[model samples]
Target: MNTRVNETERKRIAAAISVWENEGGAPGQDSMHHQYGRRIEADHSWTIYHVFTGVPARFGGDAMTGLSRMDATSGMLRLNLRNAERRRERIELSSFRAVPELAECGS
Candidate 1:
């Protein structure tokens, strides 16, 4: 399906993602949220893989307004998946912000 979100919904989702990240992600972690999204790889891991905002209809209205939404997020999931030395090294050398070597999901 092609269910895109609006700017308002984007901000809302960003806030929700921030809350989730605050509770689970490590303290003082380097991320694209802090950086200006110069590092695509790093940003991708957080904005795409770790969070649910990347998913459609996970929050806000899903064909209806004023309805509660369910989130399917596994905070820090990728960090555990990519436990390889080389992967970590690549992310580190990326500059701007190093992307976490996010591991795969098991479902």
Candidate 2:
């Protein structure tokens, strides 16, 4: 029930959203793997997830140091980051309630 949202975290979420929108819908399973691998190649500091169709997972930089996965059917995105300090700024599911369009595939 923590409602606190920081500016940096907001910006990061916005960036991730933009990336998801501009990249054309939630990635397919293979595309998701390739995208994550490419992103790791470009910047190993961040991780990616698509827990609900087109909704991209937004992790705190520190909260994404290790491994993660998005279970679309269960709407659960699990993260196993090594740093506790970085995991404090998670984007809750409530934040996405208003953006239902993100859950649909784009043409």
Summarize candidate 1's per-residue lDDT along 2-105 as a digit string, tens digits: 34557778889898876655344443444433211111122232222323333322223231112222222231233333334445577665642433443322
Give candidate 1 misplaced runs (Cα > 4 Å).
1-5, 25-107
Worst 10 residues of 2 by lDDT: 73-82
Candidate 1: residue 5 lDDT (0-100): 54
Off by over 4 Å in 2: 1-5, 28-107
So what's the TM-score on candidate 1? Answer: 0.20
> Tens digit of lDDT per residue, candidate 2, span 1-107?
24456777888999997656433345454333222211231432334433334334544533333332222211222232222223333344444444678544321
Error of 2 at 101 (Å): 44
